[model samples]
Target: MLKARVITAIFLLIGFLAALFLLSPLGWTLLATVVAMLAAWEWGGLMRLVGIQRIAVALLLGVPCTTLMLAQPEALGLSGSLDKGAALSLAWWFLLPALGFWTLLVPLWLVRRFPLSGTAFGLLTGAVVLLPTWLALVLLRHLGPWALLGIMALVWIADIAAYFTGRAFGRRKLAPQISPGKTWEGAYGAVAGVLIYGLAVYFLSGSALALPLLLLIPTLLVLTAVSIIGDLFESLLKRQAGIKDSSQLLPGHGGILDRIDSLTSTLPLVTLLWLVL
Candidate 1:
């Protein structure tokens, strides 16, 4: 299992890096759309959709992505400038709501242990969870691949730090019902790790982020907490769905959704923040 996971991680990293640095803007958008589509399919599994139904759900989610790419190419940074166009409009119209969902509602849903129910609710929620993330992937990469990579690395650092810290010092549970493996100590470790990473990037990358330390530190802390919320939220869904993993598509890594779960939550907010400030 470990060997499969390592090999898979290596390949995924290589493919992701190639796409990130080498792909054209449209190519990157298409790749992100494909990822969103697959995640939507797994989301169908969580909602109890089967076979063709899952495929349909994937298509349903993917259509809007392709539509935005084709219909409003400028908005997606595919053709023209996104500085004062639909992309800015979308920052408010599309991603603001997504930001609200992640920062406001998801934490409540997590605490209440809300039951995932109703087809309409499920589908709408899936869109809320997905579309903005797809947009974030497109916009953030366009801003700069290394910028996007640095932000993503914050999440990776947090996750790694949390795992080791939890093993070493975990005592009290963070979310015992949703994910028993996580702990408050681990959460602290994640925050610390992210803070260190944020500071390093700020110093090393010079004007890359363009935020002062005061603002940057708070932002990093918030994102780290939200990343944990994202992970916990997915774990809750999988628990309620009575499944071990989202799907078995990624060999030992569970599924695409399993891998990008934190990204779904964090990316939209990062994009929104960049747009705002």
Candidate 2:
């Protein structure tokens, strides 16, 4: 597992750098859409939409919907004058729906006794997971390579901090019912790591951000919290479906959804928050 994880990490790092630096905005958007589609496929399995017909339905609904919602900035009220920096900021703020999924869907799932068993439910869940992340990637490219690098750095810092903190001092579980390994200590570490990363971005970049550190601190906190929830949500879905990982697509990572579960939630929230504040 560790070897698989290392190999996967190396591949992801290389792929991320290439996508961020080398791709045009349209290229990035297309790549993000493809990734989201793969995630949607994993989600379909988790939701028990496994047959060819069900998977086809998911792809049919997901592809066009994601493209329309995430790729077309004009539909989302973004103007042509918006530079990469402004677009990235806006994208960070547009994550409200993804946040709403946790706020609304988790309770609904529990109250309804986790009624996410059907094909329709799976498709709905896939939409919720894929659309925001797709938009985030599209918007990241729109903001230019540096913005993409900055976002990836924040997520990487949080993930690394969480892993170390959880391993060293995770006495209290954060979500024992969903993900037994996660803990509050790890959560705090993740938030701190991202905040430190954001501070570095503030000093290093010439983006003319107002109250940059202040904005980044709260934003990073929110993103981290959202990221944890996203992970747990996927775990819960897998538990309900009686599976271990989302898929075997990424060897150690299980699947693309497993790899990007946190970003799926964080990116959209960051986008939306950037837009509003």
Candidates' lDDT values, in order?
0.90, 0.70
* Residue 262 lDDT (model 1): 87
- Residues 1-277 of candidate 1: C-alpha lDDT, one tens digit per residue: 9999999989999999999999998899999999999999999999988999999999999889988888888878889556545677877877999889999999999989898899999999999999988999999987788888988998889899999999999999999999999999999999999988889878887643568877888888889999999999999999999999999998889998898888889989888877877
lDDT (Cα) of model 2: 0.70
lDDT of 2 by residue, 4-57 (tens): 989998998899888778866556666776777777777777767667864675
TM-score of predicted model 1? 0.97
- The reply for model 2, stretches above 4 Å from the true place, is 65-96, 107-115, 206-211
TM-scores, all models, native as reference = 0.97, 0.83
